[model samples]
Target: MAELKNRQWLLAARPAGMIKESDYRWNETAVPPLKDGEVLLRNLAFSFDPTQRGWMSMDTYVPAIPLGAVMRAGAVSQVVESKKSGFAPGDLIQGMAGWEDYTVTDGRGMLGLQKLPPGTDPLLALSLLGITGLTAYFGVLDIGLPATGETFVVSGAAGATGSVAGMLAK
Candidate 1:
């Protein structure tokens, strides 16, 4: 609908350890229109956590985010407009829409707004119920192979996944 003039944070100089704000840069750029089978999403929210910190480190851990590249962050967005099948405008969803106002989603990983739980609490579904929930459903329990009533400990105890895992452990 509106022109895609968006701004975002990008990894600038690679960091040695615990990523600093200076390691990233704020940028303004124009997003292109979505082509056939593509939907343009207006980003609503994004997640910043430990892995992103790893990405900011040396290339051995993960590729560096070249100085001018837009920083990689997992995000959710609402469809402002769409030409793709299975997606309509105004749908709320979660996925990798990056950190920008408008993103051209190629019908890739777009979640229909109707499928989200009927509630207004963004944090519940966005961070907790969405990716974090999916991870909790599959990660800790799946990977750890906990038996019934096994004592499970979540490593990143302060984060979304750990919080959910801790609850599920009880």
Candidate 2:
């Protein structure tokens, strides 16, 4: 517990237009001991998407992440320790673990602390095959519904969702 360091990026202030490093504060704290029904996650990779801006604003699908708190972001992590029945050590999980080296959860009130299939690539799971991929999939198939040969335009063309949607559309 005391040996483990939980490095985190905390939101220092809201962005005026574009985000900068000064907008966040980085620090490390000891990883607390896991309680019953909780699991300790060692984050491997983080997902950066356009939705992060919305999260910085006053409101969106979810409440804005409070100042001085860990910046909110999805991550692909491994269960380093667990006291929960549904999880075990070495299990790969995807969830909203924020911008931190480690997180602790009870598998509750999270995006979905889903376990990745054995041997699943963490990079793939965190990017094109993750939320961005799902947003593109639904946007193009459900919302756009373009027929063959129809031209579709993407707004944030270079972003995760836009890039993925473009590829899927093509």
Candidate 3:
């Protein structure tokens, strides 16, 4: 149909004490053509987490977000164009889409792009069914390994991951 303009928030500078609006710069650019094994996605939802601070400031499990690059964040997106197998137009997917209206990927990153089952809620897919849920699932089932009827204590039970961990423990 019409041409697409990709809106983006690029990392301008690393934070000093706390993050500020000036740390990022807004930009809009033309969506690039897809190459083989790549898929173009329109972001629908974004996941904001405390770990993103680390990603912006220092090198952690993943490298820090480079200046002049899109600020990193996980997102739920819909495929707009695909040169990759198993992904097609209109498919809903989740992965590291950063702070952008559009993203192009080859299903590779910290969490590779994954297709959402039909009718899945985008918000739920990015939250409880995404990294937060996966972290709770692994912690409670794999690491804690609490037996039935055993008391499971979850700190920060009001937070995202902890709340899910508490629920999964039940």
Candidate 4:
């Protein structure tokens, strides 16, 4: 087979106040061969979230994206090669991936690799069917716990999470 190049956007520098195009640098490298227990993925879609800013600027739930490293983001991807059990080529999965054309994972990151159900919408898997939807579902049901007839108010009702939360509350 032909060689595959991995295109990436690396974190060039940390932002002082606001993030800019200068904060990232473009990169391309040969796709590495998969190791045992690792799976190769071709990124199909990425999820842009407000928390990624915090990830770029400082350590929050996760450490900051280091300078010269691939910028971190959530993505829906298709498995291209697998040395791992339970995953095979052509299977669609979602998890924490980087801003790159290809990714290699051992299925043990923060979100871990999850096989998307057949015919699942990739875009929705990144949003309403992924973390955003889960956050909204649990936040409202577990934390908020509004009873019948109680008015549920979502603060950021216009955002992905808020919009889903509002719908769940209805």
Q: What are the RMSDs of all candidates, in order?
A: 3.4, 1.7, 1.4, 1.0
lDDT of 2 by residue, 29-144 (tens): 88889899999999999888778888877788888889998987888999999999989899999888878888988877648698999988988987877898899999999998
- Using lDDT as the measure, the top candidate is 4
**Residue-level lDDT for 133 in candidate 3:** 96
Which of the predicted structures, 1 or 3, would earn the higher TM-score when compared with the native? Answer: 3
TM-score of 3: 0.94
- Give the TM-scores of the predictions, in the order they appear: 0.79, 0.91, 0.94, 0.96
**Candidate 2 lDDT trough over 10 residues, lowest sum:** 104-113
Report the number of the highest-TM-score candidate.
4
Reference-based lDDT, residue 108, model 4? 93
Off by over 4 Å in 2: 1-3
* Candidate 4 clashes between residue pairs 3 or more apart in a chain or in different chains: none
Judging by lDDT, tell me the better candidate of 1 and 3.
3
Tell me the number of clashing residue pairs for each predicted model.
1, 0, 0, 0
Ordering by TM-score: 4, 3, 2, 1
TM-score for candidate 1, residues paired by index = 0.79
lDDT of 3 at 60: 97
Q: What C-alpha lDDT values do all the predictions have?
A: 0.69, 0.87, 0.91, 0.93
Give the lDDT ranking, best first.
4, 3, 2, 1
